[model samples]
Target: MSIQEKRNSDFFLRPRFSIDLKENPEELLERITTYLKSDACIYRSNVADKHVFIDIPVRKSHFWSPQLHFEIVKVDKNSSTLKGLFGPKPQVWTLFMFVHFVVATLFLGVGVFAYVQYRLGESLVFPIAILVALPLIWLLLYFLGSIGKETGKNQMKELHNLLITIIEQ
Candidate 1:
């Protein structure tokens, strides 16, 4: 079935809230968690400098079609309002950057090595090696990066959930 059709067939409800960031992150999180636990809301966020866009689910179902999604609900518009809520956690970003750097270094090093080997009287072997390996290396890197991003997204979601739980009590 088409995405829209699938969505229409499934249960879909958007959570109701009037979010304002003037309150502290902890307070806001507490309120959100209270709402979530009471109503079993699922949520996602698109964080930005001046605003955070949140999507809260109001349906009661194990599964929802991808097309059955809610638009972003703006929470905050002032950067200062989100100081504690928006900035990257140092450890997470550090690890991510480290992994990215390592992957890039490995790719460049292998590419250069293959090129040098070809130049050192390996005949056309090195060129063929490079042709085969470079694309594969790049593709692998791309996939790995994508996986990392997905992982990060999952982690963020979990963290948000955890924060909600902590604030609820």
Candidate 2:
């Protein structure tokens, strides 16, 4: 958190935050870059222009390790805002989305097949079982994602703290 930090309680998959600071945006970005380069900095980070990417070291990271991506935007000559997102590594996110897509497709396919079987007076046991099961699987995925977020919550906090430190300087 900086002078003012906005917490987005509605975003689930990727928590969002923004901080307002009374400092020049470009100078703030450069200061962040220099701060992240110090020997004492523990997080692995990349600073390019007004954007910063911060992550836990790979050896200490898990599939669900959260990463921070943020940008600085000038609001006035003497003030700027830092907007950030905390999310799963891009690969994990892509895989999660892909799995959800597959589950949805399977649900639709099975529903159509069940309708056809019902029309033909065939037993609804198997298709209905599958249709019932897909939703449960989706729910499981949702819970798993929430669990992952909880698992990485501390690391996300650490990353945010680092940003706050850089911004304060």
Candidate 3:
């Protein structure tokens, strides 16, 4: 199987891969199920109602890890296209987005308030300090997200291997 993967630095951007397989969708799905069940690591796997979701923790009990999704679309009677996406868990992604939003809103609100106070000749030191700190916090969060991605890098590779092995077979 030939797989092409795309990646980006943004935390929200997930790595996606596309591959064409000689087998039909059902056969591909069967191979994936077999692989997941035979793997030693316990994965939260679900396949029903034409939906597939797999959660393989990078480490057992770890708070964060990437999720893998697969969809098989039949292109012909003997060929199918497999699409794969790898990203962090939904809750973790949502929480990160919420935190970033809060930081940005606070920064803007305080910035405007600080500007008004400055126009009225009030102290700028504390407001400026806070305004400066918010961006720094945001940057720190970006770095932290990068760290989280790095921490899960190995698991990402494992998931990729699992997918490729099943598809190639």
Candidate 4:
């Protein structure tokens, strides 16, 4: 299946609208908002495939910034497919938490091993091992994080391009 199809299958409530705009950004936004207000939940507006995903929570608060909560995937002249991808914030947070948990587990295990080594009257192998492993663990985590970000960006870009194609037709 296509990426768009995959996304559609995943979303419980995906309301997508495509518009060809002659008006300015402000007017286009106003028009899109009017159409979106009816749903009052999850809606996507794609103007020539430059997509803006909006999420309206149950409790409305003007103090909160929608941009922070919602993902706005845009496509410009210099934009790559990488720019269009957006990973869900919750999933990203969860991934980071899992990484931290794994790192903590490794540290705890190493500490216990070191304690046992000390009880057996060994040299400073535990400390040396930890010093070497810590940096390696950090490097792995950094690489994973970068990979996730790049994947999300690429997905968003592909989605934007697909949306644009759909809108054009």
Candidate 5:
């Protein structure tokens, strides 16, 4: 019943964790499949090979709903390990990453142009403003991710509890 928390970077919106289990890998997968398929489950789930994905029901979801993804790794013949992650939906993750990439690219491009303007003795106001603003925007993105994680905190706990229950059984 020991679940150890691994502190990945403090800003990581997607949290990764692992649990040691005494059951075999196949048995763990089978248990997740069986539980997800049974009537007692309130969540939606997908099982493929050694991986399992759990989602909140659509009727009770929001723009920041969390998803649980886990993989069972074989640890010798008599035991297995369950590595799990809690994150936003793939599309949302992609969107955030794309925005970050664009912001970074713009920051670089704007910085170069601003430097050129400075060297040319032209107006430095606009590019300097942009340079300052880009970092603020980046910081905003980080805070937004933190806010989103906080928004989905309860669901994260629910998903985690469900995984613990499955693994403990």
Candidate 6:
């Protein structure tokens, strides 16, 4: 199995990859459905329209494992474009996005307050400390996300391997 080029940013928790297959969209989807049935780790496979969604429950971990989604679009009579995305459950992903938004909004507010205080020649110590703390919290969140990514790395590989195995067959 050769390494597949992942199309995700370093800071992103969701990873995606795409490739062209020399099969019609229907044939590709059929092959995928057949493979998912035989895969022990995967449960709850759903295919709708041209997309496939699979649930991968990890062992001994309370957190939800990342889901795998595939979209197959026919390019011609004998070719199709396959795009895949691997991501955490919606609740987990939304929580992370909410945290980021809150941190950024609070940081901006604190920075504005600090600037205003400085212009008035007032004490800048407390506001400056808050300004620093917000970003530290943001950085901490980033590192935590990175750690989460690392924790899920192996599972991600498993999902990718399944895709490759099915496609190659």
- After TM-score superposition, the amount by which residue 90's alpha carbon in candidate 1 deviates from its true location, in angstroms, is 7.7
C-alpha lDDT values of all predictions: 0.41, 0.89, 0.76, 0.45, 0.87, 0.78
Local error of candidate 2 at 72, Å?
Answer: 1.4
Any residue pairs clashing in model 5, and if so which? none
Clashes of 4: 5
TM-score of each predicted structure versus truth:
0.32, 0.90, 0.77, 0.38, 0.92, 0.82
Flag clash pairs in model 2.
Answer: none
Instruction: Give the per-residue lDDT of model 4 (tens digit) for 107-136.
Output: 877887788778888886756689579768
- Residue-by-residue lDDT tens digits, candidate 1, 1-169: 1111011211112112222234455455445445545545455444343344443233521222111111223345421122223112334445556766876776677677767876786666645665676567666755654554444444435444543353334
Structure candidate 3, residue pairs in collision:
none
Tell me the spans in candidate 6 whose CA falls farther than 4 Å from its real position.
1-12, 37-41, 58-61
Q: Write the per-residue lDDT of candidate 6 for residues 59-120, one digit (tens) a residue.
A: 53336467788898889988888888988767788998999999899989989999999999
Write down the RMSD of candidate 3 (Cα, Å): 3.2
Which of 5 and 6 is the better model by lDDT? 5
lDDT of 6 at 75: 92
lDDT string for model 2 (50-95, tens) is 8889999878899889999999989999899889999999899999
- Candidate numbers, best TM-score first, in rank order: 5, 2, 6, 3, 4, 1
Instruction: For candidate 6, give the lDDT.
Output: 0.78
Residue-level lDDT of model 3, residues 63-141, one tens digit each, is: 5578788777788988877777777788988988999999999999999999999999999998899999999999998
Prediction-by-prediction clash tally = 0, 0, 0, 5, 0, 0
Ranking by lDDT: 2, 5, 6, 3, 4, 1
- Candidate 4 TM-score to native: 0.38
Which regions of candidate 3 are displaced past 4 Å? 1-13, 34-41, 48-51, 57-59, 73-78
